[model samples]
Target: MRGKSAKYILKVDDDMWLNFDVLLRILKTGAIRFSLGGKCNYGQYPFRDPKNKYYVSYSDYPMSIYPPFCSGTAYVADSDVIKQILTISPNIPFFRLEDIYIALCLRKLRYEITNIPGFHSTKIYPLACLYKSPMVITSHGVSASELRNIYQASCDKDGSMYVPKNPQQLPERMILEQRWPKGKLARKSFKYEQQLLKHNLF
Candidate 1:
């Protein structure tokens, strides 16, 4: 389809869910050669396990370290890179890793892969709120219904719209922090302590 002259092309897997708002925001920044939705692999090795879904046989790829590639869940590529891939693909040996295959083509063309935050490839459940940010691009392992739910939640303007980066801080803590003013928090804590003492619970 890229040959038809599309300026940009976004490719995603069936299980991968995308936040179009965030994607548009990134593209507006300009000159993006390649942007993957999830974590970027710098020096990843080939999957050696024959039983693994991503396993690569020695006949396919003999290289010890793969060229830096974007996670296959989702990625956006500029037309130039697409053309480059189409031009060089026949010359390169076929590999099962589609993402790496594209990456190898880019490497040969001397193009760098760009990174956009919030494009997750992990199986971890996604937080509904983070979609408001331009950084959050893709989430893997989401069902069709859940994708709609996430899109609706992304439109929410309440303080409940943040995605927690640290697992240690629970949602309750976040709510408390956002819901109360600094002075009010201190006073509220003090009053709670007083009530505890009055009840002889302290």
Candidate 2:
């Protein structure tokens, strides 16, 4: 897995809305080799559900080390480290809670797993904050509606403090924003091209 390529792994929760353009810019800086997405505590885990057959916690096993936080999202290590882990533990037992298990394994191997701040959500006014935060992770606790509200609001002109565009141009603008932020006109045109391709309008 150790090879020279320009790529970064981001594990995002299903409910999380990432500004891909912003993320791409961050990746371009090359300061971060691996990144993990913050969790939004909206979904239920198998361990929490009473119906699950395989559910175990650190409390059950005294020797097991519990992760500092639940791992809804995490960054994969660089290719070399990834290869080492794969080679060393190719046939590890399949855990229902793979996120925490992976974190524990990485920690045991002396890999640093960082928690990104400002990437989370709260019950207050704005559902999400789109700040240029040094920390890159955030979570929302058990509020799917809030997540959707934040997403929609972020895409709205009047509602969103970030990327506010007219409703008619919102979709195209969003696509453009994801692709290229510096070249506004080019991004808009590129968005049109993308729409044509998606709808076979060409």
Task: Please name the candidate that would achieve the greatest TM-score relative to the true structure.
Answer: 1
Identify the runs in model 2 with alpha carbons over 4 angstroms from their true place: 1-6, 34-60, 67-70, 74-79, 121-202
lDDT, candidate 1, 1-202, per-residue tens: 3457776888888876677766776677774744333357798988899999889887888889998888888888787678778999898877667899888887888888876665667533344554444545676776776566666652354323343344224333322232222465546556533432332210
All candidates: TM-score: 0.71, 0.46
Which consecutive 10 residues in model 1 have the weakest lDDT in total?
193-202
lDDT of each: 0.64, 0.43
**All-Cα superposition RMSD per candidate:** 9.7, 13.1
Q: Residue 56 of model 2: what lDDT?
A: 70
Cα lDDT of model 2 by residue, 89-183, tens digit: 65554455667656545545666554433344431112233322222233333246645544443233223333223323434443223233346
